[model samples]
Target: MGTINELLVNIEQYRLLGYAAVFLLSFLESLAFVGTVVPGALFVVFAGSLAAKGFFDLGDLFWFAAAGAILGDGVSFRLGRRSTIYFSETNRLFKPSRLARGQEFFARYGGASVLFGRFNGLIRAVVPFVAGVAGMAAGRFYLWNVSGAVAWAASHLVAGYLLGTAWRTVEVWTTRFGALLAALVLVILGVYLLKRFFVRRGRLLLAFAGSLLGSVGEAIITNPDVRTFVAAHPRLCAFLAQRFDRQRFAGLPLTLLGVSFLYVLLLLGGVIEDLLASDPIVAVDTRLDNLLFAFREPTMVKLFLWVSQLGRGTIVVAVALTVCGILALWRRQRYILPFLVTLGGSTATALLGKVAFQRPRPAGVAVYREWSYSFPSGHAVIATALYGFVVYLLWRRTAQWGQRLNIFFAGLVLMLALGFSRLYLGVHFLSDVLGGYLLGLLWLIIGVSFAEWRRAEWGPVSAAVPFRSRAAGAVLLVGLLAFFIRTGMRALPAILPANGAAAATVTVPAAAIAEGLSRNRLPPYTESIAGDKQQPLSLVVAAGNEGALTAALRSGGWLPVEPVSFTTVARAAWQALGGGFPPVAPVAPAFWAGRPNDFGFARPLALAGGKPGREEARFWRTPLRTNGAAVYVGVAERIVGYEWGLFPRLGADLDRARDDLVRSLAGSGVVAVSRKIALSPPMTGETLAGTPFFSDGAAWFVEIRP
Candidate 1:
């Protein structure tokens, strides 16, 4: 690596040296035998950083890196193809010892050894040489060798460019930079936690995302009114809709009979159903056959399939819910404590089952549908945790026992909605959803029971019981335990060190890893964000035009951000971050701006009659809906908790009284209707929702036309 770095540096010091040195160094480094002794990592990294700083062109370093790699591998290939006879029976120019070592590894691991060997320092170069001698084709050998070289070069070069070169510049802004980084991290974690907390409290963004995709399916089906206007366009209708007549139910009875038989075998026969290949509950045997038939018509099924992929499970959902709980706590919402209890119980129950089962998935399951490992369904458990706890959380808030009973029953419906989605998508089995519900219910029972018992011991939930001394003691104990572990690990160096006389080489002790790590991480400090940016940054603007706006707000220490994201992010980001849109100002006179429209005029005017607001007061009030999409309204007050619905337009009415309470927020003394407002925009893009999941990919993009 050092030698390679020098070669890169010399290329700029002298043009001829740059070209020649790069070519030769790359060839040797990537070559079969000579690459072993050649050193280049430090040189390439140093050159990469220098290039980033404008001392040399970054492209020069990249070319040298690539040229060196290509030439080296090409030479190795030639050597392998031509020198197989001489090398196999007897070694000449190369040491027989090195080739002897390579043959052993190659034979044991086969083709994979060629790829993985690029990282094994002791035998990387020699293994290729052995591959040559072992009759590997030049084309196949080059493929793996080149792939490894490109990845290897890109990794080091990128690292040097980002961490080494850039970190050096960032080192100067240590104080403020650390503060900003910490604050940003906290804000992100906060947002994530808040979203998760809200989700657990019944704000289902995942559901919304899924619903968006399903709307597409529902759209395609209803667009031409195939069900209604089929007679008008018979040919088009026949193609668009599944024409069901006598054959529509051709195998229906058989399917139900088979399903019943399978269920009986599963529950009563005591047979090992897995061995019998009886797995996965289907509503009917013909379901798969129908699915297959639909799949055969790729265009028709693509939209439905896309919806299922949209429901990709995210820990972010959980994290956001936690953050929401934190906000609820900060606001002292009555629902706060119960929300946390529900989430805590849900998480504990779900995770315990996942660990307990550790069940393997069915073969080709993921390939067919987006299937994760089976256990108690996360959806079911989380749902139960929230809704079951909701009953207790709202116990005292409700005025009547009937109302409580109504809410309890409603909560059950929600849990079913969540639990059923898991099975509807075929991601979980019947038992998985059922087990999840039981697990969640069981945990809920225990939590409620424990809380009931501890209520007297802990005092009222609203009362704050401060304990400074106990907190200090706990913090100190943790610090001491961490220190003890550090000392134990450090002491281990004296007892153990690699001892290998056969490989005559310098041995680095494991203890040295600690020192090396520290040196690598710690950089010289500075106090500026400008000098800190020795290399221009490739800013990743994730928030669309919002990033453009934020970049303008940045101090002179930074420049305009180079956006890397697409347009859709602006919509999502706007929603997630108290999202909003600029006022829809008119191009001309803007009549509504000067004079209130029916929306505003109707509100206050409605107060003039017998009812205070219903008459003239109607001129001042506007209706708002709680659509499932995330929303932010620049209203005079929060409508969710207050002014819930339009009521009798009277000063003495519930809405009018509640309006006085919520008209102001924590920061603002008076809330006013602001121009900027956020509404749950129609969803766009890929998500995990209604349909099914993927066989191989971690994420997927849903295709929908506006």
Candidate 2:
């Protein structure tokens, strides 16, 4: 908190510099070609966030941003009016074809293009130059440009302000949630990039493989041993050749689909078998359930609930009906039956699996009660079958490979999200979702094969869909969307947890603490998100309340660590780089059971040669209390040095840190009784931060006087 105060004071002292920076970024962002490289909008949004913090005036930021943008566009327009020299076929930044496209867009929309293009990153710079080259009147151009800049500035700043307001609510879960979000983003980006590479180079690679295979085949067929084998089995060879004939519907296409169907069927069976036999997959299910439950926040809960609704029965039925109507109007009658069959088959398969397994929904971790059996997720099944078919249809109709790849990846993302939502909500296990996907894919293969055969028999679809048919399809799509919105709104309340529900607390007798520790009823060590052991619990304190515990620690020269945030983190970085460390520096989080530490404290340590160090402890308020007093489980470690001038390096002796903290508390005159008890077998381990330490596995159980 002191660091935040200092930061605010510094910002106030340099307010003019902040405004100047915002203006410069906005100005550079509006210049043609340069705008493409400048993140002007991002800077303005950050300035708005600062305004929310009360360091800058929101109104002043808006005016500066707007003025900068206006002046920048005016300069770009003037350059365009002077010459076309900058825009040539050879210039990568300002290509002739790109300018031509911008001109075409400007011609189509007139002055309105300026207003709309300001929001589009690709054309925001090009449109204004195109307008000037087309001889648009200066008065008209400035009118549109000023209006666009003002609107753009206002929208970005307001968004940033809203983000700032919500930062407090978001900060608590930022570390864990940020890691999850980053992983998801990387996976999506990798898939998209891979698809692009395939779309661009797939044919050349396939042609090369074909030539290599042809040469190998020629060599094999000419060998005397192979010729003898083929002569000995002419009928077998003929059968194999017939099955691989690509020209016939019952040949290679059917063979490939049949193999895919069998593969998916086997995978689905394996999941079911694993569940029945209680394999390692079931253990994974429990661990993931606890991990996601620990990371749950209200905002994320609501988000996943909204996404889960996309797979609901009402929404799927509405979409199916709408697509059927669309296909009927467009004269694609063959697809309607196959689509319905795929959706219906997937739904039925999910229901049957639920009945066959009779697996109960996850206990204790679910956000809301789900009465249905949980062997296979219905949401996952419907998402795969319905969305997968829709993407396939779109891919067939689209002419561009890029568009087709995009459609495929979009469908993949949606399906994966639906599956994750089920797991996050604790309504389905990992294996259940996987089983659902396999079943859905199996049915989809069958449906697509049937559709393909029908198309081969009936002939290709009509060359074009008429305008009337297209209009009718659009109206039906709009109706479907409206129905979905209304139904989802009604269902959201039922899916979310009740407002009255609170976390349940457990109380244990004080005498049982020793027994609990011995039997491992209480966790013996801190864990990572994946349930790997980190540091051992070496401190256990019983206090009448949090106030008494905090007072005792403060009296022992320990200060509470500040919460991790942008301000505190920046302050820590600055202090670390300058070779001075504060007593209340923000500590990296550690998890116990499934949740992060509830409290952290540190005392500055003097090292040899005037080096800086500290002793830190993190504690969690356990659910088990004794005799109406709160019980805290904690781990203590000494920071002996620094790593990379940022991260703290831990001392090798964990026992010394624990003993020092106990002695300090005893000397504070707040301890009623303190004793060391062996909690677990002595061991050496590494912390989550990769710092190695050894402990005697004994903990000081201190009781604070009431």
Q: Which stretches of candidate 1 lie over 4 Å from their true place?
A: 1-16, 84-94, 174-706
> What is the lDDT of every predicted structure here?
0.41, 0.80
Q: Mind giving the per-residue lDDT tens digits that candidate 2 earns over 223-328?
A: 9998899999999978877787789878888898999999888878878887888765765677677657655666667778888888877888888888889989
The parts of candidate 2 lying over 4 Å away from their true place are: 1-188, 205-224, 273-281, 494-512, 518-520, 545-616, 621-623, 638-652, 689-691
Number of clashing residue pairs, candidate 1: 69
Q: Model 2 — which ten-residue stretch has the worst lDDT?
A: 168-177
